[model samples]
Target: MAVVEIYDTTLRDGSQGEGISFSAEDKVKIALKLDKMGFHYVEGGWPGSNPKDMAFFQRIKNHRLSHARIAAFGSTRKPGVPVQEDGNIQCILAAGVSVATIFGKSWDLHVTRALGTTLEENLAMIEESVGYLKSRGLTVIYDAEHFFDGFKANAEYALATLKAAVRGGADRLVLCDTNGGSLPEEIAAIIRRVRDDVPVVLGIHCHNDGELAVANTLAAVRAGATHVQGTINGYGERCGNANLCSVIPNLTLKYGHETIPRSSLAQLTDLSRYVSELANLHPNPHQPFVGSSAFAHKGGVHVSAILKDPRTYEHIDPALVGNRRRVLVSELSGLSNLFYKLKELNFNLDASREETRRFLEEIKELEHQGYMFEGAEGSFELLLRRAYDNYREPFKLESLRVIIELKENSPVYSEAIIKLTVGDQVVHTAAEGNGPVNALDNALRKALEVFYPDIRRMQLTDYKVRVLDEKDGTGAVVRVLIETGDGERSWGTVGVSTNIIEASWQALVDSIAYGLLKNNGR
Candidate 1:
């Protein structure tokens, strides 16, 4: 089997994703991460298009890379411009990189409509641009823009365009699915035909518009493509690019191909979540393989069976990808969920099966009252530990009072008066904020600061309130979910009650306790 070189375009293509923007410093951080992961190539960005990317190349030169080569991306010289006079081509050379990748029009329609150039002229541009870079001692990777679509519209023209790149000494012809509409079978067929005719090394670059980018990439690999291009977390314009998070494992485990070394495979989940954090996007819970819930089992039957045999419900061992199995206790669960969760928490609940039955009924009743535990494992853990004889209380809330005052020309203000007992100490504090929730958070933290000053680092990253029954006209039960982060890691805690304020308090208290407990090793 041939080795497939992994090329990442995360810094450039991934920034094109909606709400995804990285500073020059952010690009450097991500570049170091990619290089450390042992990728073959990391395409930094288009130097000619933006100053941030241009700075990345200049700044990245000082650090020595161990594994990956940095590639600069650009388009071929403009339709009628000389390669020497093209500003974009000059930028690529100025970046001082070993590898240079340039995209050129492959589709006849793009040549006639988008570029307003003749087919023969486009071919000349591809040859001239590629030859110019290769002549300058740069390893040129020619991205055949829209190669698959071009093959469908005019197969002869597409093949001719690739042939032009080869004549110009392009090292690799990366077939691009720009419109991202092609399926896997179609991709495989096209790649096979291209290999039969085109003598150069072939590569694959696909978008996820059809939700088949990974599938198409794998299909191309099976058909003999030697290079694959993708972005981490599938971040890019539109539906995003091929997700290396999914493709890398699939190639390594399922296809017996290696992108990164077997040891680096464990870093896949952390890498995925790291990128998600830098992008400031929540990790998709349902994302395959690396998602938080990827190995989570909720149904009692599923969890019970997994304790017997993980392969009964799981396709691959979650630990293989640095993820762990999660048993979620919900209204849909049974005693097995509690047993699994309690054991993980190291709680020896010496209860008979009848007592376990009573506990299950209690959980069902609370869930019916809108207490959701799945997203609030911290709160659930506290509840579980409370059932044991050795469990110790962290702090006890004595009282809380919140006041909302509306002004004539300003926004409403809220103040919270709180009292708490930490061991034998009774503390009282008051704090004001812009909203009721913020005020409550401030008051609680102020009271706890004397005892646990590290609690000051807890930041409420997310808060969500769901109305369980909205028809009750201000008397409905609500569920409040809060996400807290302690500079390094984060967790979710939840509370439900008829009063939104009360529910918010429950989650806020749990968020603080969980942060202290986990970080301080309580």
Candidate 2:
């Protein structure tokens, strides 16, 4: 079996994605993670582009990478300038990398129209650029920009451009589907033809315009390519580049290719989340291998079978990708599903009776009012604890009230007052905020803090509101989900009501109360 090389460009091409920007610190962290994950090459960034890339190179210069070589990406030299004098080429050298990648126009239209250069000059551009990088004692990889479409337009000319790079002593020739419109069969055919003509090793770099970047890359590998280049989370221009989170495992497990170690595959899901959080990008729920909903089952039958044996519903054991199976609870849940959920919460269900049925009915009633327990396992656990007599209310809600006053010449303000009794003491507090929900949350925390001062350390990290019945407008039922973090652990709580403010207040109150209860071991 041939050894497959994984080239990760998450910090470079991935950063090209709109609204995606990574700090130098973030790039270094991600680079370290990818290196530990055993990627063969990590394209740090385009050193010639901006200060961030330059800073990234400077910061990571001294760190010891265990498995991956850090490659600096840039374009070929200008039409008239020598490669030695080109600023882009100089920056690549100054970046102090062992390997450098340069992209040159391969399409005839791009050469004659976009670049305003003749065909022969473009070929010279490729040759001279590669030759200059090699002379600088850097391993050069030539990226044949628009290679697929260029081949379709002018086969001989595109092949000639690649030959120029090979003759100029490029270490590897990377075929790029720049526009990402080529089919899998086209990629395979092109890879075969290119491999036959080039003496140097071949690699693939695919975009995701047609949503087939991963497919085309795999197809190319099957045909002959040895290196697969992609961004970690498919972050790139337009739709994005091929996702390495999906490709690496596919090639290693499905195709039996040797890339990352099998034992390290389990880190895929967590690594994906870690990178997403660092980038401040939300993880795509449907993304293969590492998405939150990748192996989640919500339907009754699906959950039942998954409970018996996960393979019955899962395509791959989620544990293999550092993720666990999640059985979702919703209107689609059945008795068996509810029983399984209760069991997971450490509840022993009465299988011979209708206990699960009663539980399902209660869930349905709560859901009808706007509550969604699926995402608030902490709240659900509390409910189960109460049902099984294992729960104790840490504090009591004596009273909660909202007061709103509006004057014709002034902005409206809302104030919430809460009176709560814990043990023998009663605490009251009033707070003002922009909205009724915010006011209530502030006052509630203020009241709680008199007794449980630790509540002050907890904060609402995220808030999501869903209207259960959209047609009803303001009268529509609303579900509020609140995520809370105390600088150590995070948990979610949910509440539902016809009024959005009420729903938010309920969730916020439950979140804080649950935190106190859990901390106090009640």
Task: Identify the leading candidate in terms of lDDT.
Answer: 1
Model 1 weakest 10-residue run by lDDT: 384-393
lDDT of 1 by residue, 1-522 (tens): 568899999999999999999888888888898889899999999999999899999999989999999999999999889999999999999999999999999999999999998999999999999999999999999999999999999999999999999999999999999988999999999999999998899999999999999999999999999899999989999999999999999999888897888888888899888888888899898889999999999999998899789899999998878887899988999788888877787767743577777887888888988899889888887777666535666789898899999879988989999988999989988999889999999999888888888887889999999999889868999999999998888888998989999999999989988888887675
Q: What is the number of residue pairs that collide in model 1?
A: 0
Summarize candidate 2's per-residue lDDT along 1-522 as a digit string, tens digits. Answer: 578889999999998899898999999999999889888999999999999998999999879999989999999998988888899999999999999999999899999999998999999989999998998899998899999999999999999999999888999999999999999999999899988988889999999999999999999999999989998888899999989999988898788999877888999987898888787886787888898778878898998787788889887888888877777777788776777777776666684467667777887788666678877877877777777756667678888889998999998899998888878888888999887887988888877777788898899888899888889898888888998988776788998888877788778878987898777765
Q: Compute each candidate's TM-score over C-alphas.
A: 0.98, 0.94
User: What are the lDDT figures for the candidates, one per model?
Assistant: 0.91, 0.87
lDDT of 1 at 163: 95
Best by TM-score: 1
Q: Assess the local accuracy of residue 434 in candidate 1 as a C-alpha lDDT between 0 and 100.
A: 81
Residue clash pairs of candidate 1: none
For candidate 1, what's the RMSD? Answer: 1.3
TM-score of 1: 0.98
